[model samples]
Target: GENVGLHLPTLSVQEGDNSIINCAYSNSASDYFIWYKQESGKGPQFIIDIRSNMDKRQGQRVTVLLNKTVKHLSLQIAATQPGDSAVYFCAENIMEGGSNYKLTFGKGTLLTVNP
Candidate 1:
């Protein structure tokens, strides 16, 4: 119920511009959140993470902001580049079935950089 469907599947941007990708999570009790970037045919690489205690976190060329009130999260990428083109996913860690930790993922946002 908290999944925010994207109005557009992909975003095209010029090189050196900033890009913002958004995601929505279903559970408010989720404790940990991570943003990952996956290049074509590659595994998702951890970009940044934010905890429930914090509302925002930053990494090299990227910033992640969380809004617990609305269960929304966003990733901001500075200086979009051809190498930055990839699919990004936001994941939330939740307790499932006993003591197991599970990560639920959003559909993903595709970023295309035009050189």
Candidate 2:
């Protein structure tokens, strides 16, 4: 959750439970969004994405929810595990023009799954 415009930045969750991470974007012209899991010494792994036409989309053990009214996005992870401990990030796809867009990443939140 954001407190006074400050992001929580870190989230701690117990293993076998669910974890929810939230993010807020500043652009209203964003056309799409994505959730990614950062890999060690590698680029972030794509998890899920939702188009502007859709508000919710589900992936294997995760879900992405978009609140256009508030320009908010969230990722829900089920059955949190120690391996799930990593920094997650949300990216917004801004459409600059036809067939041309750029990705703007929001701040990352470090999720710690406690065993």
Candidate 3:
């Protein structure tokens, strides 16, 4: 099986500081986008999402931005904490045909928050 999500770029931040995670999507046809947080021994959890029609979306302390022109995506975390330490990822939904779509994920990045 091919690995769709397997890379770790380390980001070190202090508690109460802002953390930004970047992801570049390969498919321009992707319409839906989602950010996921995966703690050790746990599965990826949905953090936030934005549609292709929208430029940005916010949820709680997190914000998701999409640039369709460049096929780029980013996640911003406000007041990064130790609890926020995890592997963060972005997934894009690419529709192949009517009612059938495939989800592609970016390489996961490790976010480390220090006190």
lDDT of 2 by residue, 48-86 (tens): 999989999999989999999999999999999899877
The 10 consecutive residues of candidate 1 with the worst lDDT sum are 1-10
RMSD of each: 4.9, 4.9, 3.1
Report the lDDT tens digits of candidate 3 across residue range 40-108: 878789999999999999999999999999999999999998999888999999988778999988878
Cα RMSD (Å) between model 1 and the true structure? 4.9
- Which pairs of residues clash in candidate 1, taking residues 3 or more apart in a chain or in different chains? none
Off by over 4 Å in 1: 1-8
Best by lDDT: 3
| Native-to-model Cα distance after best TM-score fit, residue 50 in candidate 3, in Å | 0.7
Return the candidate ranking by lDDT, descending: 3, 1, 2
Model 3's TM-score against the true structure: 0.91
Write model 1 residue lDDT over 1-115, tens digit each, in one string. Answer: 1222244378889999999999999998898999988887777889999998999999999999999999999999999889998888899999888688899988788888999
lDDT, model 2, position 107: 72
Error of 3 at 34 (Å): 0.4
In the predicted model 3, the residue pairs found to clash are none
